[model samples]
Target: MFAAWWKLGFDTTLLAFEAQSVIALRMAKLAAGGTAAQAEAQRMVSEKVLAAGEAAMQLATGASHGAVVAGYRRKVRANHRRLSRGAKAI
Candidate 1:
């Protein structure tokens, strides 16, 4: 549903970002509730899960016909870079 709609130009990138953010928050929660070793393991597993999700989203969006998803991803990376630089200036 989301991937298809996103392919149709429905702000899918934001959805992906939101999903990733939620996963990060969950990772933090797990870290806070566990011993150091447990936390580390949880973090590592969480990172792998997050990375997989990100990769899938990227492939799904990037490999679409006519490069539509790829174009969007490029613009997003450019904007993120700009924002990071701006934050550094602040």
Candidate 2:
């Protein structure tokens, strides 16, 4: 009876350890995924800003029509607002 009790205790401890390990692994995966998503979002914002800069340069150089420049400016402002909102969310 004593040996049986010892065996059961050992098994319970082993199972608990395994459960903790699984939980830890899941947490690590979630953290990595969040980091990757944040990086992608930042990259997208950078691209949008660069495009906006290009648009402004073209406007300054008088390379595009007034209507086109105005449209690009509007798009840039929209993107900036979106980025700001996302930042607030984070």
Candidate 3:
């Protein structure tokens, strides 16, 4: 009976350790994935900002596509207003 109890206790401890290790590994993977996703999102936002700036410059120089650029600028302004309102609410 004593040997059986000791064996059971050891087995429980080992199982607990394995569970903790698995949880730790999963958390690490999630953190890494989150960092990668954040970087990608930032890169995409930068590209969008650069494109918008180029469009604005073209509009300022009275480019032939003024109508299309004006529409895009309007859309961008609407999005900014929506985002600002949401941020203020938060």
Encode model 2's per-residue lDDT on 41-81: one tens digit a residue. Answer: 57656866876787677878776444444454455455455
RMSD of each candidate relative to the true structure: 12.1, 25.9, 26.2
Off by over 4 Å in 3: 34-90
Q: Is candidate 2 or candidate 3 better by lDDT?
A: 2
Better of 1 and 3 by TM-score: 3
For model 1, name the residue pairs that clash: none
Looking at model 2, residue 29 earns an lDDT score of 40
Candidate 3, after superposition: displacement of residue 61 in Å? 82
TM-score of each: 0.32, 0.34, 0.34
Off by over 4 Å in 1: 1-34, 63-90
User: lDDT of each prediction vs. the true structure?
Assistant: 0.54, 0.56, 0.54
Q: 57 in model 3: Cα distance from truth in Å?
A: 70
Q: On a 0 to 1 TM-score scale, where does candidate 3 land against the true structure? A: 0.34
